[model samples]
Target chain A: MAYSDKVLDHYNNPRNVGNLDKKDPNVGTGLVGAPECGDVMKLQIKVNPETGVIEDAKFKTFGCGSAIASSSLATEMLKGKTVDEALQIKNTLIVNELSLPPVKIHCSVLAEDAIKAAITDYKAKSATPATAQTA
Target chain B: MDNHHNCWHCGTPDAGSIFCRYCNSLQAPVPNYFEFFGMPLKLSVDLARLQKQFYSLSGLLHPDRYTRRSEQEKRYSLEASSILNDAYRVLRDPIQRAEYVLKEAGFDIGEQRSKDVPPELLEEVFELNMALDELRMGDDEVLPQLDESRKKFLDILVEMDAGLEQQFQKHDAQEGDEARRAVLAEIRLTLNRRRYIKNLVNEVDKLLTARNA
Candidate 1:
């Protein structure tokens, strides 16, 4: 299938593709996969403990153009937002931004799931006393 | 659909027999895979016997034998033969058989758009995919990394295969629907993991072949 220009661009030059220091107390990592397509995605967020704002975001996705584009846009939308605000990033918005076809909608959903997993990891780490509390 | 049978050709009724007694013609309409093979719906099948039955049935239903028969009988022969081939293909493999039974029992084991990646393998799979992407993009420098990931994924596949055998036996040994469903779920998860690993293997092979070319 022909990918839209937006999808091709994001896929070709995916934004913020890398790994975060998962062991760092301020960083949260989310790893997800779609068994059907045999695709895997990893999304990570670094949170500022003092302000509860996201400092940076990164993603690595192994799938089709749509999955890569979805996570690329996910990280781009994540930076600078508060943890709670980042959670509001919708899969539909990702779909719109990436111009993913209906068949690729699950890729967007996987992206959403990855971000939520990252936020959950952040919250779990924050609850631990070792991590600096993000009030 | 059970406890009653009628010969499509001669209208002679038979009680649950696959072939009509009066006309001695195959009469079941679209039999389930197990029923088509005249085997019990169980996981542990005797392959030699299955193969023997398959070949024998194929001989009887060969299109060559139907050329001189009535058109309606010929159609029935073709349909039965087609279903027979499909049934044997699915039943001969343990994994395929497990999946077929699950699907026949109304469970959607997996699909082309499935997104249920096992949680524990996410990190490893992510790294593997990165290597795959790099390889695909012509970064030959990452060949060592790709090779290492392939070995690791292959080990996982081996482990999953052993686990599948245990699950398959468990499925066949279980009696109750609840117990069987639990085993089937485990089988589905194992199959999904194997599918991912297989795709990884295919990707690695592609890169290796490209380099050689």
Candidate 2:
């Protein structure tokens, strides 16, 4: 099957791919996998803790070409958005943007799943109580 | 799929004779994987027998054998070689073989999202989910609880797996189709439970990984 030119371009020249300090307080990291292809993707966003804005975003994907493109595009969409805005990036939008085929749509879905997972991780960590006041 | 060919070793028909099964020349391609590997379709398969069959067949069908052949013949050889490898991969793994059998039998357990994970797995699934949730919450108390649950569930699965083997032996030896169908249903249920428990264990592993992550 002939892939989209954008997919081939991204596959040949992937951008902004790296890992974040996943344990850092200001980073929201999403890790996800696809059942059909057994692919893994990790997307991370460094958010401004006080303002809730994404200062930077990066991804590392291990799968077929479509998986790489989906993650690459996901990071592109996330950069510079507020953490809340980045979480709202939907799988459907990613799929349409990439014009992914039906069988390859899960690549985009995995990307979306990673974004949600990362944001949820950030929220849960933020909600944890810090040092308690002495009695 | 028509990978059948004439054996050049002695010009005997390749369809029915891999390595002649007569003169042992290592130059024939049997029909499907099971026949090629000389294995019966059974729940309790002998791994040793299966492995022996594969090496023997690979000796005949592997792509390296066609290096001196014409381009057309070499392409056919390569296709057959990959299929041979893929067949072994599908058959040797119990879970993969079971899924292939289920597909051939026209049954889909449904996608993972169909989370209508059978009611039988509810309690175990629920407990697994809770363990995952707690682990996500960074509760150090979760792994021990999951470890205990995993052990109990695995013990049950092992017992069931043994029972199915015995039942398979009996069913294969028995008479009527009615009796065989009944045994098959029982086997299916047992396999289904096994699948669910495996998914549960995977969930627990994911939880542990996330905690460390």
Candidate 3:
């Protein structure tokens, strides 16, 4: 199937494809997989404790081009957004931005799930008194 | 089994049998694979019996025999023969057979998300992918690690197959629909995990072959 230009562009030049220190109290890590296609994606965000904004985002995805592009675009979208604003991110946004086909729409869903998972992880960590005091 | 109909040729009432009792004409084929093979709806199928039935049906439904028959019989023969091939192909493989049963039981085989998978399995899959990426980038030092990973995955596949066999037997022996449904759910999860590891093994094999060549 022919990939949309946006998908191809992000795939060829994936944005923020790397890793963050999972041990850092400020870092929230999300590891997710699509069992249908055996695709695994790890998305991480570093939140600024004072401002409640995402200071940095990174991801590593192992799957098809669409999957890679979806996560790549997800990280780019995560940066600079407040925790609540990031929570508003939806799979449809990824689907629309990537022009994903019906079959590949799940890739966008996976990315969206990753974003939520990371935010949830970050929230859980920061909620703990020990981590909150350290931050 | 509720497929009773009148034979087109002889007007004989048939109870969904492959052939009409009165005129011995080939009737409309049964859509269900288990019924088509005259076997119980069970996951642990008898391969020997299935093969015997397959060979017999292959000749019985051969289109050549319908050349001189009526248009309806010919069409029935073609349809039955096609279904016969598909049933055999699916039932012969244990994995495909389980998937067929799961699908028939109203379980969605594909379209699963990461939440359904265990975290540990995902971690293993991720590390394997990382090793594969290194190997692809010409890191020959990772070859031994890759080989070990391949063996570990293969061993896991073997263990999973054995586990699936146990589940198959459990499914077949269950008395109630609820009990069988429980087994089916477990089978689906196992199949998903198997699929992931199977893909990893294939990737490792492909990369190793390329490096050797």
TM-score of each: 0.89, 0.49, 0.91
> Which has the higher lDDT value, candidate number 1 or candidate number 3?
3
Ranking by TM-score: 3, 1, 2
* lDDT tens readout by residue for model 1, B1-213: 252666777886663444677786656445788877778778878999999999998997776887987787678788888898899999999879988988987778756433456566777777777777787788888888888888988888888888887887888899998999888877777787788788878878987887799
Error of 1 at B180 (Å): 2.6
Residues A17-100 of candidate 1: C-alpha lDDT, one tens digit per residue: 888899888999988888888778889999999999999999988788999999999999999999999999999999888778
Alpha carbon deviation, residue A57, candidate 3 (Å)? 1.1
Q: Which of candidates 2 and 3 is the stronger one according to TM-score?
A: 3
Of the two candidates 1 and 2, the one with more favorable TM-score, higher being better, is: 1
Worst 10 residues of 3 chain A by lDDT: A126-135
Candidates 1 and 2, the one with greater lDDT: 1
Candidate 1 ranges beyond 4 A from true positions: A131-135, B1-3, B15-17, B111-115, B136-142
Q: By TM-score, who's the top model here?
A: 3
Interface RMSD of each: 2.7, 7.9, 1.2
Model 3 misplaced stretches (Cα beyond 4 Å): A127-135, B176-179
Best by DockQ: 3
